[model samples]
Target: MVGERSKQAFERAKRVLVGGVNSPVRAFRAVGGTPYFADRGEGPYLYDIDGHRYIDYLMSWGPLIWGHAHPDIVRAIAETAARGTSFGVPTELETEMAEEIVELVPSVEKVRMVSSGTEATMSAIRLARAATGRTAIVKCIGCYHGHADSFLVKAGSGVAALGLPDSPGVPQSVAERTLTVPYNDADAMEKLFADRGDEIAAVILEPVAGNMGCVLPLPGYLEAVREITRRYGSLLIFDEVITGFRVGLGGAQARFGVLPDLTTFGKVIGAGLPVGAYGGRKDLMALVAPEGPVYQAGTLSGNPLAMAAGLTSLRMLKRAATEGAYDRLESYGRRLVEAFCQTASHCGLPATGHAIGGMFGLFFHSGPIVDFETAKACDQALYADFFHEMLAEGVAFAPAQLESGFMSMVHGEAEIEKTIEAMERAIPRIAARRR
Candidate 1:
């Protein structure tokens, strides 16, 4: 149950903030209950305003790869802030951040910094259109690139959670220019390309489909998309906002060995700061800004604080990668998946899950969830019960069933055990509800 303080805060927030939350999913609309207001976070734990402590797996929706309020990141932000926060002019830190991204990501030869994932993706689309001299962009049905007009056609996350068809504000002209295809269906993608290949400037998608619950690319699926895009003279854009550094140091393109023409990144890149980036082949990226006609600019595109914090985090991640930190995250995620599945079995409830790097997803449905169609078939009502139950037991997952869960480096065996124990209780309660 929500504490009185949180309830009062929410009521107060409703008077000022739209929907009583900045983000739609944070409103707890999908799961029936008052949203718990966060007071602070440390390592793997988040303290709600009501004074409840939770072993947090939300990880601020995948930005906190090192967990919340990491000392190093905090120190970096402090030091950078002491110097200055934002300058409309270029900074050395921005160049350093760009160099780091160029070195780590295989597809990004020249990168442009942005304020959020939406900005990164929207700019990438614009660059693709300019580079290819085409008008249409293809996106997977449930793979959310962002809230950009070109991306909201069949987006997931909050859009799916709210059961909205497509955002109303998006013009019909723009929506039509954005093609839609089912994720993990190579045949559908191939067919779509065959019919309208000439009109497409790019095909953008989440290489791992985190928005629709961490759906993995079907074997050879990414390779096929790459081949098709290359043959059709259309750019392939990988929306790695959620998967970038979270999956591996080099991101999904490196992990899958399938390079995209352009890649958009956020979350882990900023190390929990407000930042995003899009980069690609030098020639393609050269078309943006002063060098070319395709114009995109932001006053705080490479803000000092964001760059400093992200640079520190990336350096730490690079060092940890040398010692197999990503492997440990994967191991932790796998353990959670096992526990979730086993507990569901014990409770006599159908369930399915997948663990990839530090990201995972749980579905209140049977196995073989591949795309939006299958992901939507999950028992959301049952998941709500499980969500509330887990919250009561001091564990936190994403509030919506459609959202993916995250694991942070700070989470150890003890945290994992506590989460599993919470699941142990939560699953049985869900089963009881079903009975």
Candidate 2:
């Protein structure tokens, strides 16, 4: 059913919006088609402008952990909106959110809200520079923090999909302060510290690299990073924007049992609303105004509607954690990935996949995708074919090979079974096209 209507809308959008999309990934360039214009999402399904209903796996790019348009979150937003929207001043809901985050996340002793993931990371880096009185930051090559000037160099996700190692508009002087190293390489990290340990202000990374197709860190990689950062008096930042509550109530830091000095969060925390947060030790956080010299502020940082939605989502996640939601997620992920692997193998196509919690990735023509380079080497054309086939069969996936897919609490036995069926039907068509 995704036919003329969606295509017409995209054609019109092209005249007004650059690439016919606000975000680069939404244009469906990797999949070689016009992107479906979503009308609305309910439960586990997305309804497109062309009247097609698809069992969604992208989950709005990793938010909506409870699924789209959950009653609780919607109701909370409605009730909060009736009171007031933004005050440009503190509210009780803001304090409650901060308390909830600090209590749940292992590394967050005090938290500050921001309007988006970009602001959270942008402010966190500034705070690190102020605390350490150093200018340099060490970031992993494939991990994406945000669109900040420093993070745009060798970023992953949409940037990687475009095959641009770095973006323009970033001055060489600003980019030089950011040192890039490969993920899961502890020896390289050690060498960097040995050479410029004193000049480095912080080391920031996605503990679980979701930007590069859900690649997990190797054994002892996080522990090694923690040790190195501590040895050199550099702050360690875990960018949990995608992994925060989606992985577990305590996030990847607690799941892996390696705590960082600071943590940045988005996605699940907002429950599909626009929000982000950064927090850390009390001493370091206090340095942000009006307590100390490091100044960071946002007018809409703690908007009431966003706070209500976030609070509801966090409460649901807490309840789910108590009721073994993570266990359910693991079971569902395993079933879907196993089914896809079996189908791909039967078609004589090399494939490997991995999943944890509610996030998963399927790499085409892969041995093992452990790092960004290995992840990028995946057969993108085959992935595009599979994506189109799956869409035709009423299953939605992340359009780009480098982006990971997400499952929500609503993705139960029925939806997972249906997705596996769709994959089985789609994989052979993709393989036949390759032949």
Candidate 3:
């Protein structure tokens, strides 16, 4: 049950905000309860309105690698704000942030900052089409690249959670220009390019799919896509909005040793601020203005506050990486996965999961949740029940099954242990209800 204050707050919000929230998934539609309003977050825990606390694995949808309101990040933002928020002209802080991205990401050489992930991806596709002289693009099914018109077809995340595969407002011709293929299926990708190779400006993907429940690429899947794109003279775009810096210091491309032509980043780079970026080979990025004609611009492209906070976060990550911090996050995620799997097994219910670096997924399916079709086949109702039970136990997973669960540097042994115990208690009750 939701606390009264949160319930009241939601009712008040519904009169003004769309669906009582800006985002659809926050309505808790999948879980069938009043969404708890967050009051404050500290370290690994989020305190909700009406005074409920949970060990938060949501991690603000994969940005808070150092955890909520981290002192360094907060101080950096405060110091930057004292100076100024935004300037119509350029700032050195933007350059510093771009330099860090270029250094850390495997594919990015020259980058352009934007206001949101949607902007980063939308601009990347536009540049790709201009460079290739083609208007068509390919995107992995269930791999969301923000809410761009070209990406709304067969998208995931909130769109999928809301059960709207393709939104209404996007035109039919626009949707048709965006081709789709099942993720982790190189053969499907090869086939698509074989038929429409000349038309495809680029193939955009989440190298490690986050929106479709943290799905990992099949072995050699990324490599095959890279080869196909190279042979066809098409660019490969890795949508690393979730995986960048969260999966590793250099991201999934570094982890898997496959480099795309262009990469888009958001969540971790801004450290939870509303920021995004797209970068690629110098020659390609050279085509973007004021260097060339394919124009995309934002007044808040490099807001100083975002730059300062992100710079501080990335710098801290660089130090933490030296201390094997990413490995620790992976280990912690694996423990939660193990606990969830073990309890489901004890209850004779189907369960499977995967954890990589700082991201994990819990599925109410037996095994091998490779793509959207398989992921959707999982027992969603059962997941909804389990979700609420865990919430009651003070462990907050993503509100829906298709979204990824995030781990943070702040979540330690104690939090992990308590979460495991919570799962142990919650799953059995859910199982009993099913029986």
Q: Rank the candidates by lDDT, best first.
A: 3, 1, 2
- List the candidates' TM-scores in order: 0.99, 0.99, 0.99
The whole-model C-alpha lDDT of candidate 3 against the native structure comes to: 0.93
Which portions of model 3 show Cα errors greater than 4 Å? none
Q: Give the per-residue lDDT digits (tens) of candidate 2, residues 324-369.
A: 9988997888888788889999999988887888898888855688
Highest-lDDT candidate: 3
- The candidate, 1 or 3, that scores higher on lDDT is 3
Instruction: Please give the clash total of every predicted structure, in order.
Output: 0, 0, 0
Itemize residue pairs with steric clashes in candidate 1: none
- Is candidate 2 or 3 superior in lDDT? 3
lDDT of each: 0.92, 0.91, 0.93
Off by over 4 Å in 1: none
Per-residue CA lDDT of model 3 for 1-435, tens digit only, reads 579999999999999999999889999887788999999999999999889999999999999998999998999999999988888899999999999999998778999999899999999999999999998999988888988889999999988887885998999999999999999999999999999999999999999999989899999899999999999999999999899999999999999999999999998888989999999999999999999999998989988988998999999999999999999999999999998999999999999999999999999999889999998888888999998898899989999999999999999999999999999999999999888
